[model samples]
Target: MATSTASYTQNQSILDALSRCIAACEMCADACLHEENVKMMVPCIRLDRDCADICRLTAAFIARGSDHAKHVLKECIEICRKCADECGKHEHEHCQQCAAACRACVEACQQYAGQA
Candidate 1:
């Protein structure tokens, strides 16, 4: 009964949010790796990588109008929120920025994820 032809890419705001989050996640991971206490940042770095990868995949699923787009978005929201929470624990500028981006992505994903 739902519109199965939806194209995620057509939603500029969501696409932009996802793209920004992906970039932020990558940057955060790199910054974490260069921190003096890199070992302590292992969890953040791992989450950042995971968030970025999932964001990218979610975007692709949406762009292709996949039947699984809603499911992908739901997963993306969970990871983005987790990543944001982890980054929020750090005081680094990169982590702060990453957290902001992750929050934005979560907000965007929430709009359509419930339809899954």
Candidate 2:
């Protein structure tokens, strides 16, 4: 059975989406680490991990309504964008899915992060 997410205040959908994206990215990174051509995916996996961590933190910050969420979200967007771009270079299915997730999260983070 799938676990359901509880309701959160302010930007709940975006936060939930980001959390999912982060998890997918993390899983993809781990899978890439175990691939035969791990060396070729090292950098992409590294950034994927980094982006996942940042997205997780950003989601928590937003959920908690922290004052620093904006700053963190700004950084998270940058990381997500970079990671997505890197992941797109790979031909693996995991990488492709992770790239899509990261892009969605990036857009959400940027929208809620601060002024346009």
Candidate 3:
């Protein structure tokens, strides 16, 4: 049987945050690749990709009302924090924006986790 998400009404905010974070991370990663010092941005780019993927998965888990949503959210929070830290080290506009998005995602994940 298909899972119902009717009980997950509070997840809407988390979903929105995840979506924004994914976009920001993707954009940051692509911008990093085009930077003159691509080598220096490898860590940031990698973290951005990781953050985006984790957020995507977390969103899916929440949307499906999966039993493992909280577990996935824990990992998502960790990755988002790491990505934010890494991105915050850079002076690039994209990096700064990505950091902000990651931070927002972390907050949303934490809030959802608390309610779970």
Candidate 4:
């Protein structure tokens, strides 16, 4: 049975991964907005937005221990991969941080996103 939000507590690994990914997305978005050539960061900006939203959704799914958690984690993995790839192309501190976070999330998802 699925757990309710009030009773939910993600396993340490899952919670840590989600938190890192969430922070990465937010940092990436803020970085893109602060780019000296903001126009050049358009793609990264869009990806950052998507990454942030998906991470949040994934976290919620895990927190509730819902059946959809695996599905959401799978999606989060794909989004993190994409975001990490994009962030790796940039030379900014935030982009670097984002890349690390995305990688961490990918590893986390692999452990928990089973049989989905």
What are the root-mean-square deviations of the candidates from the true structure over C-alphas? 3.3, 5.6, 3.1, 3.8
Model 3: ten consecutive residues of lowest lDDT: 1-10
**lDDT per residue (tens digit) for residues 15-110 in model 4:** 778788888888789878977899999988888889889988988877766888877778889999999999989999899899889888888788
Query: Which residue runs does candidate 1 get wrong by more than 4 Å?
Result: 1-10, 114-116
TM-score of decoy 4: 0.85
Better TM-score candidate (1, 2): 1
Write model 3 residue lDDT over 1-116, tens digit each, in one string. Answer: 13235344577888999999999999999999999999999999999999999999999999887999888999999999999999999999999999999999999888888877
Alpha-carbon TM-score of each model against the true structure? 0.88, 0.86, 0.93, 0.85
Ranking by TM-score: 3, 1, 2, 4
Query: Which 10 residues in a row give candidate 4 its minimum summed lDDT?
Result: 1-10
**Pick by lDDT: 1 or 3, better one:** 3
Candidate 3 CA-lDDT value: 0.93
Ranking by lDDT: 3, 1, 2, 4
- Candidate 2: segments with Cα more than 4 A from true spot: 1-10, 114-116
What lDDT does the true structure give each of the candidates? Answer: 0.89, 0.83, 0.93, 0.82
List candidate 4 segments past 4 Å from native.
1-10
Model 2 C-alpha lDDT per residue in residues 61-107, reported as the tens digit of each score: 87777899888888898998899899899889999999999999887
TM-score of predicted model 2? 0.86
In candidate 1, how many Å is residue 17 off? 0.5
